[model samples]
Target: MAALTPDTVDIIDPDLYVRRGYPHDEWAVLRREAPIYRYERANTDPFWAITRHADIVNVSRQPELFHSIQRLFVTINEEGSPAPDEAILRQLLNMNPPEHGAYRAIVNRRFTPRGVQGLREQIDRITAEVLDGIVDRTECDFVTEVAARLPLAVIAEMFGIPRADWAMMFRLSNMMIGPGDAEYAGDETILETLQRARMEFFQYFSQLCEDRRQNPRDDLASVLANGLVNGAPLPIFELMSYFALLIIAGNETTRNATSGGLQAFIENPAQWARLKGDPSMAAGAAEEIVRWTSPVIQFTRKATADTNLCGVPIRAGDELALFYPSANRDEAVFDRPGVFDIGRNPNRHIAYGIGEHFCLGANLARLELQVMFRQLAERLESVESAGPLHRMRSNFVGGIKHMPIRYRMRPRA
Candidate 1:
C-alpha cells in the first residue's frame, strides 16, 4: 500500500460521524491501509488513529512507554490545543501507574465481588421499580425513561448524593460526553458546558467531602472523603477529581451499555428469544452486548519515546487513539465479527479496555447488566419498537439517545 499521508487518511469530524451513524466500512478500510494513520483537523493537533486490535493492545500494555497522563482523548479546546485541566486529567483513567494503582487500590475494595454481591438485592429492587414505571406506560423512551435514569439513580445512591440533584448530575454527564452532539451544542459564550459541568461537579463533591469529614457514612462518597492514597489522606482537589471520575465513569458508561443492550436484543430477536428461553445466558448475553456496543470508543495514549507500532513509526509525544470498536470487531479475534451472538463464549473483547487501565468498575457494570437483563427478560411479556431510535452524537461514548419501545408487562409473582 502507498505510504499513508495526512491527506489520504480520513479526517473524521466527530459531529458528522455521530450524525451520519459511524459505519464500520470506513474503519475496515483504515484498519487495512493505515492502522496508525495521522488525522489532522484544521484547528486541532494531528493524532494517529490506531484501529487494529493488535496495535490497541500493544499501546495499552505499555503504560510506561505510552502514557495516559497527557490527555485521555483526541479532543481539543477552543485554543486548538489539549485542555489544560490536569486535575481533571489525573483521574483514574488518565493516571499512569504507581499513582494510578495507588488511588485505584483505595476504591477497589468497594467494587469487589463481595461488595457488589451485597448490592444484588438493592439493584433488583431498583430494576423492579424502573420496570414497574415502564410497564404502566404503553409507550416510552427507553433511554430517557428507563436505561438512563436507572444507572444514574443507582450511582447517586452509591455516592450518597441528594436525590434532588440526580437529574442535574445526569444532565452534566450528558454535556460532558455529548459535546460533539448537535443537541448538546450550546452558545460559545463563557466556558463549554463540559467545563461548566466539571466545575459544578467539583463544587458538589467538595460539599459532600466536608459533610463526610464531619459525619462519615458507609457510602462511596464517605470512603472517598476519608480514603488515603500513598499512606496519606487524599487532598481535597484529588478527592473531588476522584468523585468526578466515578460519577462519569460509573453513571454514563453503564447507561449507554444498558440502552445499547436493549437495542441489540431488539435488533436480534432470535438471540433475544434464545436469551429469554434460557435466562442463565444473561451473563454471557451482557458480555456480547458490551462487545457489540463498544462504548467508551477511543482513549488516547502519548508516546513517551519514539517507537514503531505494527510496522508504523510513532514519535515521542505523538498521540494515538486506540479505537475499541474496531478492536472488538477484529475479524481475526471474533468468529462472526459482525454478528451479535448472545452465547458467545470467551468474549475477551476490550470494551472495558485491557491491561493496566482496565476499568475499575468492570465487575459492578457486569453485575448491573446481568441483573437488569434478568429482570427485563423475566418481566417483559413483549417488547417492540414504538418509534425510530435516536443515537447520541458522540464519538467518545456512543449509544442510543432515545429509543421508543412499546412493551407488554408480565406481572411480578
Candidate 2:
C-alpha cells in the first residue's frame, strides 16, 4: 500500500469507515504533515480538515467567528435533496451563540452535575437489569443486548416514553444516523430516507407535545412541550427538533462508547484486569473510553469572517470539518495518543467537544458511562468476540452496528 497523503486520502468516505475503522493512520499523517489541510473531494463539498487538538479547540471556542449555523452536520454526499422543511434542522446543534445559549439553558439545569446525580440511582437500576438478562447466557450481542439497552431505557424514561416505544426510538435513530448502512438504507436515497425518518419523528413528537401540553408531567418531554422560552411557547418545529436531538444524542453516542469501551478491554486484557481490580477507576475509564471512541466523527462549521487558524488564512464562508476522533488522539496533548489506558490521568480529550457549543448532555453521558463500566468491571469475568465486528456505514457517526461477544460474569452479590 502506498503512503496516504492529504490529496490521496478520502476521510469522509462512509464506505471507507465501514470497510476499515477510523482512519487513524490517515489522520496521523495529516496531523503531522498538514494539520489544517484543505480537503477537496469529488461529490462532497471542499473543506479544511482540522486534525490537530489545539486547532479544533481554537475553532470550536470562537463560535462567533466559526459559526455552526451555515453547516449543521457533515454529510457523506448522498444522492438526493433533503426535506423541504429545513426548519426541522433549526435545532440546538445548529444555532449560534445568543440563541444557542438561550435554547441550551432550557434544559441545561437537568444535565448539570447535581441534576445527573439525581438520576444515578435510576441508572444503577437500569444497568443491573440489563446485565441480569445476560448473566444466564454464555453469549450475546453486546452492542444490541447489553450496551444499547441501558442508555435507551434511561433516555426513554427521561422522556416518559412507554417501554413499548423503545424499539421505535432505536429504529428511528439508526435510520437517521446510519442511513448509509445497507441495513438501514432503503430503496430511497439517503436524504430521502433521512427526510422520511424526520417526518416519522415529527409525527410521534407532535402527538407527544399535544399530550404533554394538555396534561404536563415531570419528564423532559413535558418540560419542553409546555415550557416557555422567552415568555412564549417554543415553536412546534423547535420543540420537535429538541425531542429528536435528545432521543438520538442521549442514546446513540453513549451506546457506541460503551460497546467500544468493552472492545478496548477485550483487546487490552491487562487494562480490563486493572479496571476490574479497582472499580474506582471507572470515572477515569469512562473518560478514556469516550476518547477512545469519539462517536461523533466530524461536524462542519463555516467561517463567519475571514480569519486565520494555525497560521493558515481563512476566508469568510469557508467551511472546516473538526475531526473529533483525531483531536482526541492528538500527540501534542495526550501522553500516549494511541494507547487506551483506563487510568490515564489528566486526560483532557474533547470527545464531547469544547467551548460554548459543547455537548449539553455531556455530564449525563459521563454519569451513564461511569456507572455502566463500574458495574461491568465488578462482574464481567471473561469475554471475547464471537463473530466479526460490524460497523455502521457512516462517516458522521462511528457506530458499532453489531459486536457479538461470548462472556461469563460473577453473579451480582
- Estimate TM-scores for all models: 0.93, 0.97
User: For model 1, how does the per-residue alpha-carbon lDDT over 301-402 read when each residue is reduced to its tens digit?
Assistant: 889999998777889988888889888888878899899998888897999899999888888889889988988888877888988878776566775788
* Best candidate (score: lDDT): 2
lDDT of 2 by residue, 1-413 (tens): 99788788778888889889999989998999999998887767778999999999999989899988534555556666453224435688788888888788888888999988999999999998899999999899999998899999999999999999999999998888876676886777777777788999999999998999899999999888877777888887788888999998899999999999999999999999999899999999999999999999998899999998878999998889999999998999999889999889899999999998898889999999999999999898899989888999888889998999999987887
Superposed model 2: Cα runs more than 4 Å off: 81-88
Instruction: Quantify all predictions' global Cα lDDT against the true fold.
Output: 0.80, 0.88
Q: How far in Å is the alpha carbon of 43 misplaced in model 2?
A: 3.0
Model 1 stretches with alpha carbons more than 4 Å out: 1-11, 41-43, 76-89, 188-191
| lDDT: worst 10-residue window of model 1 | 80-89
TM-score of model number 2: 0.97
Name the TM-score of candidate 1: 0.93
101 Cα displacement, candidate 1 (Å)? 0.7
- The CA lDDT at 199 in model 1 is 84
Q: What's the true lDDT of residue 369 in model 2?
A: 95
